[model samples]
Target: MSVDDGILEHMFESDFASADDKTVVAAIEECARAEAMLAARRLAATAELTARYTEPDEDRDHLAVDGWRMASAEISAAMRVGDRAASSQMCIAMALRERLPKVAALFAQGRLSAALVSTITWRTQLIVDSQIAQRIDTAIAQRAGEWGGLSVARLESAIDSLVDQHDPDARRRMREAAQNRDVRLGKRDDVTGTMSLWGRLSIADGELLKRRLAQLSSQVCKDDPRTAGQRRSEALGAIAANAEGLSCRCGSPDCPSAGQDDPRAAHFVINVITEANAPNTEPVPATPAESATAERAAGPVEPATEPQAAEPATERSKPRSAAALIIGGGLIPTPLLAELIKNGAKVQWVHKPPAAPETGYRPSGKTARFVRMRDMTCRFPGCTRPAEFCDLDHTTPSPAGATHPSNLKCLCRIHHLLKTFGGWGDQQHPDGTVLWTAPSGRTYFTHPGSRLFYPGWDTTTATLLVPTGPARHGDKGAMMPRRRRTRAQDRLRRIERERALNAIDRKRWAAPATTQPSRPPPQNDDPWKITTDANIDTTDTDPAPF
Candidate 1:
């Protein structure tokens, strides 16, 4: 081939590689750059539409301008996928053909957002049958002399009120049907389950059960670390060990052995046999080996540690504070510590902090308990996760600032990592709003209805009361009402909740941070768990039966 021919062939069939590490990296960077540019162009187009269509300076002419702007914005957004020139022609055609109000009063009065208003107008334009929106628009246009001075938002609101007055059930039916549709699509887990066993099962439990079963089906043949189901099964083995005494090996379903109903019995029996025969408990009063191991693990058991014996309750409840062990250390700041104390929090220590800037150091679990309870989820716009499942994100780093309640936010693992490590530029406003500037320079704000606020919890009615304190070292304070502290089982429940929630959020974004769902259906709506005071006791709840 000639030189030009060779060059053309190389460009089309480059051996640079379809999946080379360096080539893939470069491709990703280039794609990101392209996306950023496209987003910028979209924003610029929006700005132009606003400038050409909105007459913000003229109060009386505002409705007409708003109508024009709304139409332009809708057309522009829809045009993002099509030929811009053709979309522009269609937009101009519709703009000239339709008579829209000069000012949309409800919009100016804050009844709606610019995007929502534009969307409504766009929907009306694309409607093949419904003349309701068009009729409303025409009515508004006719009264431009009287309502022309009103805001676009106000105009929209007025139309809605008129529609509602004529047919109140119209909006209600639409809303209810939309909600029901969401519930059926597995998009809303709450409505699916709300009964004692059946109700909640139909709602959140059923969905969770489905997800768990799917995960198990995919994991059984893997060689990685044990699956969640295995861990839970093993933990239950410790509790269910004594249940076998009540069981009979009789073949009848009526026999207590029927309760076993082992799903993975073939493989599980072999594993159980291995565990049972691994080692036996030491014989007699005490064994030196067992004693030595206990001493090494927990130092020494003091003779005085034995408390006065008390009557045991019929039902034993799980422990409130899941701390591994309480230990002593030099005082951290009191304000910071008090916030934690006021919230029922447990800590697990690492003994020392990270020595390098590159190493990410998080607070022990005790601190996690505090921070997680404080902000509950990502303070970023539209993000949602419960505090218990969140990472304790320091709004400002130490050495530059102190660890105060205001400086902490509970973000899910994804948001935390994104803020700490990703190139996303973030800031917290003085008023506690969070703003994120995307790579495209589009600013996203988490304000009043955004993800920045934590719903304050009322835990006073519970047996475990987080103390009110003017804290001091050596303060014994109030002991927890119960001594049982292992909550690893409950931790699994939280993990499940996080997973379900992550899934929903992922669906919303069309791109998920993790494989899990964004938000699980609310626990209050689950059927299988004990529900008292709208709280689901996840501690003892079984995984939903698929």
Candidate 2:
């Protein structure tokens, strides 16, 4: 029988239930080896496909824009993955094929797991010299089979040490990470009216923000019921809305901060869409003072602040018992929604979609807002980037593609680049549906993300008819934007700069301390300063009698 037939027969014939513990353990090891071999095969195939699409020309470097065009898109379609993921896979595949042949061989021999290979490739990516890379690869492969038990952190450190030994400059030193500091608001999860905050800030800025939050949290009266964490969260919100301070909820009549108008009260505008006659749709009192007094009479209450606008909610005329939708936040509980409106929050109603598509090349504000509300996220398949952060791409290049809602769709910058230069094409339909054609000729269909949340609302628009002819913005002579410095050049410069800084620190640390010279005796003043062997007193040999 062929190898495939034999493997299938063995797979069916295995009787794990009848096996002893030793046999079970051996079987598990065999399965792990098989998994590694399978992963190697997958990477090999990916490498082959990438080579086919991104073959280099003698006149131009493969690293240039032209060679990699459409390569990632092809991989993305074949693997049914996002563009970023496909590009990462391609990088790993190329690294194995061209730079780390020894490690790749170990992977193919079922001795190294996929995770280990990934870590090894990433840790050694800075080694620009092929000779050094090969040396490190061989060194790693020789012992990688014994590293199955190592955690991810340990594995990375082990690989890094090897690279550092061979080429100290190539060691991955990411001191520039502070330059990438950012803050992000997470999508709402199951928690009602709450979302998580995530951020990476400079050390100084982070400490400052933390101290500021703590100070604000302490502004509340001692009897406030909220926990420290909750108080901090409220304080962050207060800072975001430019509010004066958190209101004290101690229910004390003589509280000093009572009756003070919140400067932030008018700044908070909440957009909520609800059925006009929906039950329990009571509005909060018109003023913060009135709302606070009412809550006090009812006993201690949860801290209240003006609600920020919910992301645009789906408009529906029919009455239903569904909870109110906060535009960007998520679902708000009915009681909480009522309380927010009572706390001097401004309410704006979104009753319907934009009336019509605009005539200008750029979409009007109304059209842009409507598109964001309808799509909710990027229209690219498997991409979940929020529409608010995406560019409104023209399905067909503009002028040929009108500024109509049907022709405009949300695409994050990366995916937008793919459609523009990566040989990917897309069609946008009247109902916010997108049909994508990747470089590999596979097609994917995606609908407006809002359809999943607001099923009853209509997102349909006027149908756009694509003109039949050559594209106005064809990619005949297109080139991907070149970087100021290539990745290899940038890596070399960064390594040199960082190593020089390190050398300065090392020299300072290792240098011997300077000693002050002994002062000379004053001229003709102290005879004890000069000593000679003859001047020693032999009479002192006898012990002194006391």
Candidate 3:
């Protein structure tokens, strides 16, 4: 038997849910309206923050002592945005506050987007003349509603057209900018090993480059399954490989470059880790099972009588008859793996686990390997960041926390910061299931690898928390383990204290209009893909002024 009267009276958060579509839809709309209102409030807050740190009178306290740099840094740290992005947002917020009242009113109405306002700001900033900039902003503000439903290209083009008409020197400025054409390569970000290219080119040069890529891409055989994007990528690679001339090679079975390595070209290398249990035979699944690893998954390996450190690169350079492709921890077709192996690159095996003591605070190389293998991806509930790519967090904190499976979990950088600094909480069970409790007392749960892939081994353990009560014969408080409060816990306490200091009104922050106009679904009926120069990410060599 259980009883709670006074304790329950202090609560408002409920566990009830409605299944009716109408009720659910109404709830969703209510949440959306509240969110729109919150967005307006958030903007207002940002504007206030900016004003505190910014000054029109350069001589008076110089805009909050810490200035725009400190202000943007504080905002970015609190809100988790890039510094440049935060500065840009602050600029727009300030502009709306001082210069664009009509746009600010539209924002208060909460129909237009922050992104759209930012876009208009970008357009107006291009006009160096203050009066012309104001004129352009006024025009755009008048047509803000019409600006909705337009693609980024059309919007940009429209803004450019207005600039062209209003400012005659804009054309001359563009011609001058065109003269400073250059290109630079960015780092590879994905499994495909494609690098980001940044540059500006003259109109004629840009057109020529496009025409060549199109011509080369069109030459692909009708039987080929490669998409237009893939073909274009191949053409670009071909161009980069030998810039003076172009090659029509697709690297398929019949292609001339299928078996031959070009002396002057670079291979697109994929870092593939070989696992013990994956099937390397024909007709292998496109994605390998999560729990397929066995003792001999990487195949037969005789233990060396004398232990000698082996280099991974040296081992990879050594050829093998077969390999199970754990490329980016994703399932790659055996045929595709074989094709890649036939080329210059081969699958790389994870180094043997390091032997580390149990009580150590830090994870050893072996522990890292084991954790990566066991978790496969970040253990933060709902996060999919590869465990290999994430930081291993001591779930219970170090010194008090041990370097064991139950004590350790993977968390991506942002999520790790959020957990350590933003009042988030996590608890791990022995079976590799993580229960995450948010600041609002809401609990979420997730397991190791996807059970859809790993059939029999996964545990279906995502469940809500149940309250605990201690039965007492006399007047005694419920006993619990005393844990050292973490920074997150302190943050939680601060939030509670702040809430207690202010009068709690549930509806205060959720002010909404009587009715919100229903947004029309995008009609993608226009079949032909309409792309423009703006879509091309020619991120300039010059650092952007936020």
Per-residue CA lDDT of model 1 for 1-546, tens digit only, reads 257978878866875556689887887667655654443344445445444544443332322222232333244324422223424443433332342332244333333333444533432332222354456555544443354345666655655554444333222112223344322222334332121112224456567756544533343223325555544443333233322222122345554334443322111100000011223222122122221111111111222111110111111221111111011111223232222222222211111112222223555443343333333345554454444455666666543423433344566564554454333556554334556664335566654221222122211111112225422323112221222322323334554554455445445656645976765555766666643433556667666675
lDDT tens per residue, model 3, 22-134: 87787766765566556666777788987875554333222122245445545654454555667777877876776566777776776666667777666554344567656
Query: What is residue 110's positional error in candidate 3, in angstroms?
Result: 5.7
Superposition TM-score, candidate 2 onto the true structure = 0.70
Best by lDDT: 2
Q: What lDDT would candidate 2 get against the real structure?
A: 0.68
TM-score of each: 0.24, 0.70, 0.42
Which 10-residue span in candidate 1 carries the lowest summed lDDT? Answer: 267-276
Model 1 lDDT vs. the true structure?
0.36
The parts of candidate 3 lying over 4 Å away from their true place are 1-101, 107-115, 124-140, 149-154, 157-331, 341-362, 373-387, 413-424, 431-546
Error of 2 at 125 (Å): 2.3
How many Å off is the CA of 491 in candidate 3? 28
Q: Which residue pairs collide, candidate 2?
A: 284-342, 285-342, 310-327, 311-326, 311-327, 311-328
Report how far off residue 126 is in candidate 2 (Å).
2.4
**Ten-residue region with minimum lDDT total, candidate 3:** 303-312
